[model samples]
Target: MALKKKKSKKMTSTGTDVNITSLMDVLTVLLFFLIKSATVSSLELTPPKGMKLPTAEMKEEPKEAIKIALSKDMLVVDEKTMVKLDAGRFPASYLMEDGRTIKPLKEFLVQEYQKKKDFYKDVADENVDLLPPPTLLIQADHKLPFGTLKHLLHTAAISGFADYQFVVETPGE
Candidate 1:
């Protein structure tokens, strides 16, 4: 019997191939840019003393806003303050337990809105090269009564503060 030898076929000429180092560098730069942009988009919220915030599932962050602080006894909107019903002192008009009186939040919100608008106008002019439109930021206490929150919401809506960013805690953190 005669033995037959098998021949091997060559697949390529030289081992030199395309260099991917530049491609890898570009990808790394792109990744870093994306990470930085994502961080710049979210907003942070901090509650006041003795006040906790509720949580939400939405992750959107609004830029530029007026902050509203809701405490157990008071409601604060950028230096403007109002005492809650339990405090026995009403600012304007509020419904009493007897339903004879009322402490409305309209005036306060209107005043605040005007103040903010003027301030923004001045600042916007000074920094024509920069600055953006304003938005509303609500940082109500978690334990705050629903009535206070509802009234504030209404006031804000009426005052042209339609855009709102409700500050809250992140779950499981």
Candidate 2:
């Protein structure tokens, strides 16, 4: 006698769903890391108004110093206006009669030096006989003339700020 064939059972699958929650978490962590790295790698300091800094291939970070910003129409020291240029010319109040020394600028530098000396003395908690040399940071416009910068440097040297660092913008990658 022929026996009835046993009923066969078939199994079917609708589809497969992928789990991406872990992937999303990893991506979020990576994004945050990149943002933090970008912010920490760069220093932020606004240049004077109407000033365009020159680009350089050098990659040295600037240290804290007395900032001197020179634009076409203004000369700022530590964000204070020491002189104003009139039609690309320095006024008499800014320069001496000999035209070799910047009177106001020198005075400002001297005052700053005295203040720094006092700060050093206070920090040492003793009467310091000799203080460290002053550090000057120059942020000049790219369009500024060499003669003007030279004169400014001369004034700084005479005012006891012999060490100088020129602040330039880094070139774009």
Candidate 3:
């Protein structure tokens, strides 16, 4: 009897097939982390001290603003007054060359109004009507009474400056 030869079975590897689900999960997690890392910050600006401003009923704020100053015995605009600042007694020598120096509060406000009006005409864009009105910020010492501020406001109104903003300290420290 001849010996029978047994054939061995050949083992072949299966073709490479990658599972895309795992890769897609990793990509999605990376995308989520990248988006979460990004951030934005907001900023706000505040005015200086001793310049506490009065509030208005309107919620929206204006773009253009002007500042005026009030002092004892005299009114000044933007901290600059025609009359000189002194502890006591008004000086005679401090006078403008035009001879018509600022002696009254109304005159000072009127002068400022005229200047602003002319300036608005020169720089204002012609295309836009009802342009932003210039806001007048009046800063008066706490000691000063409301009468002075009222006069200043009246003067501004007369000179076509209808918009007004009062600068004052908040009540109660």
After superposition, which runs of candidate 3 have C-alpha atoms over 4 Å from their true positions?
1-64, 83-129, 170-173
After superposition of all CA atoms, the RMSD between model 3 and the true structure is: 12.4
The order by descending TM-score is 2, 1, 3
**10 residues in a row with least lDDT, candidate 1:** 95-104
| Alpha-carbon lDDT, every model | 0.63, 0.82, 0.54
Top TM-score hit: 2
Residues 1-173, model 2: lDDT tens digits:
99989877667666889999999999999999888656453445689777899888897777788888887788888888888887666776778777868898888888988888889888886565577688888999998888778778889998888999888888655
Cα lDDT for residue 66, candidate 3: 57
Query: What digit string (tens of lDDT, one per residue) describes model 3 on residues 105-155?
Result: 446556766676667667884433354555676665665556445555655
Model 1 reaches what TM-score against the true structure?
0.51
Q: Of models 1 and 3, which has the larger TM-score?
A: 1
Question: Over the stretch 1-173, how does candidate 1's per-residue lDDT look in tens digits?
Answer: 66666666766688789999999999999999888665554545556677778888666656656677766577666646655645533444464343332334456556766776677768675543333434577887676666556666665676556667778766642
TM-score of each prediction: 0.51, 0.73, 0.41
Q: Measured by TM-score, how close is model 2 to the native structure?
A: 0.73
Segments of candidate 2 deviating more than 4 angstroms: 1-43, 125-130
